[model samples]
Target: MAKKKKKDAYIDPQQRELRELIELKKMQQAAAEHPEEVQAEFEKEEPIVPKTFKEKWKNYWYHYKGLTWGGLAGVVLVVWLIKDIFFGPEYDLSVTTATKYMFSALNDSMSSDLASYAEDYNGDGKTDVTYNEITIYLDPEAENVDVQMNAINLQKLMAVFAGGEDLLFVLEQESYDYVCGGKEGIFIDLSALYPDIDIIEGDKLILNDTALGKKMYLNGLEEDVFLCVRDMGGSVKEDDESLSTMERSLDFVENILREEYPDKFPAEEAPADNSSEEAR
Candidate 1:
């Protein structure tokens, strides 16, 4: 059988189909006599049909499903990260204290009480402030020191300093100047924030003297507890939330410095008169 020469010119679909069908039927009839030769001819004349997108995609996924799924997961993770970074709840202020005990112990009472002092800076429909407590009593270089514990304490303190997010610090008076801001101090001068009231140093507030200190039992402690802000009386540069925290810290300080103190903290009350009881 003679084969038709290949041509570049297009043919009508119906005519092309009819012609191909006739050729196939003829080859099928002749295949009984010369099976191998007819099969070769049929293979040579088979049309090159383009695969549809759906069929191509199926084949592609079969070979590279792992790569495709991994890429999709990466894309989803990136999107989620972007959303969290751009629109996430930030702490209104941070209280970092280097004390014998952790602040988490009183977190519930503190959070409930302090919630009334601050506005929702993060706009999360609730007030929030982080409470961090670290331990570092003796100097790391002191004689007979627990090197490993001191090292851990130093590591935590260094981390806190490097983070720079702690708005306020509650530290022992002796450690205040050395740990925080040297002689001048890194704290915002409360005198400027509250010109009327005479507090500790211009920046420092002696917690032992305040109602807050009484509530925390600071008076009984051997070391005097001092509260100070990181802001340098407008001399220091502000980070992203520094100013916001400064504003909130001032409000919180004002609440703490209120003459009557926050009502939530149990106040020292006079015992009831026994005169009426004696009369009875």
Candidate 2:
């Protein structure tokens, strides 16, 4: 007999069908028993919902719109208030008033009879002031001449105005005395005219003693009174009488300058000239 044929290792089709049928039956029974539990577990889970770009933007705007708009409005209001306070018409008026008073006092102090005569020395009905004995042209473009005079008079007249017996005593005693010593500087007693004036160096309205005399001669006064006072040095006491003398001297110089060089006198620029010119 030929060796018995080896049996195939693969399962028969009938057995495979039986196994599949048995698994199917077991799965159905398990599902029937746990249906309520499965339903409850699915119900406990939350569903996912995606957000759109538009919806996100709407949420952001709702949260921040009031804050953004309020901040912007606050900034604008604050800026407007600052401009109104500092750059408005009221501020301009205040400046104009201060300038007017300053110039008025200066004009009064310098307008002496001697000054007038010097101005009309040529008798041409036109004033011609001389600087350094040389005539300087007065033009509309010139800076304020009064301020120059104030500077010159302060230096030249300090001793005549501030030096006296009382001042000498104070100096001897090594005390810083500020008594007027019966003297009057050019700017003395004229406080009403220039309320804003200060005796500080480099100030536009204030003048040092040396600077006062120098400025006067430079502007066209022929008098050298200030030079004589300067030669005395700053040894004099600040007395009322000395101060008065200084004022008189300054007045005299101012008169001479105005008469001889009226063109150099500081006057307000006529408004008409500025009306048509371009703003600087």
Q: Root-mean-square deviation of each candidate, in angstroms?
A: 17.6, 29.2
The residue-level lDDT of candidate 1 at 246 comes to 73
**Decoy 1 TM-score against native:** 0.53
Query: What does candidate 2's lDDT look like per residue over 158-258, in tens digits?
Result: 43234431111101000111222443341223334223323221102222133333333223433212111111224543566546434443443344334
Worst 10 residues of 1 by lDDT: 1-10
In model 1, which residue pairs have backbone atoms overlapping below 3 Å? none
TM-scores, one per candidate = 0.53, 0.17
Worst 10 residues of 2 by lDDT: 91-100
Q: What value does the lDDT take at residue 115 in candidate 2?
A: 34
TM-score of 2: 0.17
RMSD of 1: 17.6
lDDT for 267 (candidate 1): 52
